[model samples]
Target: MQKPKYKRVVLKLSGEALAGDQGYGISHEIINSIAKQVVEVVKLGVEVAIVVGGGNIWRGVAGSARGMDRATADYMGMLATVINALALQDALEKLGIETRVMSAIEMKEIAEPYIRRRAIRHLEKGRVVIFAAGTGNPYFSTDTAAALRSAEIEAEVILMAKKVDGVYDSDPLKNPNAKKFTDLEYIEVLNKGLGVMDSTATSLCMDNKIPIIVFDLTKNGNILRAVMGEEIGTYVGR
Candidate 1:
């Protein structure tokens, strides 16, 4: 058997991905499919920490009043991430994978508080850890949260799963001439201003020397393929 390239990874899943075809809320079929893939990676001895976005539930900033405070809106977004965290926790456990939900915001009844050392311990013990609440601060994205957790946990890479196959020079949906990049250096992504992730998220990975593999999560087995470091998607690294 071939050795997996990475021993540990952080997966950043957008809430919309959890919605599946409905485009809203938790879809059991989608969650089950994702859980199964995660189980396969864990079986390979790859520790996984996941950071989930809240776009499907709500983006408070998108609904904030013109006079509303940005911090307040961001707080709402954090709660949305918590909702996603709980849903993922349930799904993973249903798949018989020991899972832990750690929140940046304190929610003692529902999950554990975000403690870096404790999270690392869980991964070492073969438990899946889900990180939620977006850095516990406003004005940050879940992408940044995933980067931060990956650095703290000493993860080998960041698996940035999306709805698309890979990053393109132009929106492939809008332009047929769009070209896909199979690989990229951090500087290339920054220089080109590609939307592989937010600028803040991209910079964090670049500074930490953590590569990101962007691929379509909806495609079966892509998560395990990424963890094995196969040539499946555009890799942005230094």
Candidate 2:
């Protein structure tokens, strides 16, 4: 019954979040949970777009470290994102939410090629659009993809769904004394090397004046809370 603070938002989901506790591969339960949450927001009349990562299935950096060609490994990582996108589409459709999977790389059989106008049109029609394949280029991250998409779509904010509740001064799991920040400026995030996102992605958001909410996706109702403007996670912006 409550109104959402952001009518249009881009959700950046990490591959590890989809993997759930197993830390590898997709988890049906996790995917379903995310789908349900997204449905709830859609019902509230929010336009949603998602950019999913592929760290669970593959990591380009890791592969390159093991002697694989950087670009080849990155392409593999992009494929991994497509896999997660299809999985998410399946879950959302099963829940009666019309969803479209748009890929950066051409995969005509399975997904529509990424078109900026078509993506916006889907959102205007109340359909959720899931963006996969990491910008169709290597040496770029899904974070950057999210930033780029959010800017393109004119989204009000970015919901950065992560396993951790928020940005911390240190790794909270490793150091109990780590400080939790409720708010941060983009320059602070970058200058401190806080790692909320890659510098390029963070800079993109900063230049565009787009806000990002980094919250724990594993927490029940957190997605909804973030969209509704409830104080739940680290808010990063100008």
Candidate 3:
């Protein structure tokens, strides 16, 4: 059997990706499609861990702008991630994939509390682990959680699955002439404010020397393509 490019990876999914064209909440069809694509990569013997965002259901920053308490709003955002996590777990399990939902918060009835050793063990056993609750702290985005978990699990790379084709100099949807970058350095992302991920997440990954691949989640098989080391999206590193 051919070996995959990366032995272990963390797939960072935005809540908007789960919303598909609806623009709000979860889309069962879209989630199922993503799960199918993930199964393809899992079959390649890649250790898969996912960190999903909660922007679709709720955004903490948006809430704070509306005068909600900052910490309170962020905590609500964490719960939103748990909801997305459970939905993803359901989609993956229905496809016959052994999946686990590990929460940073203590929600024992629904998920396993985030334990570094337990999460690694789950990956070692070939079970897909979905990390929820965003590091169990307020003011931290799920992007940060993905970076944090990737470091903890020693994942080779972070697969940043986005709705856009890849990172563009400007919004591709808004700017017809926006330049697309095939690759970038982490400092460029920060200095240029490219918004590949938040500053903290980008900094964390940079400090840890973990490469990130930003690809379009709208396309089927992109996950597999990323895991196979194919040139699919913007590559960020060094």
Assess each prediction's global lDDT (C-alpha) against the native: 0.90, 0.96, 0.95
Query: Candidate 1, residue 19: CA error in Å?
Result: 1.5
**lDDT per residue as tens, model 3, 23-111:** 99999998999999999988888999999999899999999999999999999999999999999999999989999999999989999
Candidates 1 and 2, the one with greater lDDT: 2
- Candidate 3 or 1, higher TM-score: 3
Worst 10 residues of 3 by lDDT: 1-10
Q: State TM-scores per candidate.
A: 0.96, 0.99, 0.99
Once fitted onto the true fold, the runs of candidate 1 whose alpha carbons sit more than 4 angstroms away are 65-67
Q: Model 1 misses residue 72 by how many Å?
A: 1.4
Question: What stretches of model 3 exceed 4 Å from their correct place?
Answer: none
lDDT value, candidate 2, whole model: 0.96
lDDT of 2 by residue, 97-175 (tens): 9999999999999999999999999999999999999899999999999999999989999999998999999999999
Candidate 2 TM-score over all chains jointly: 0.99
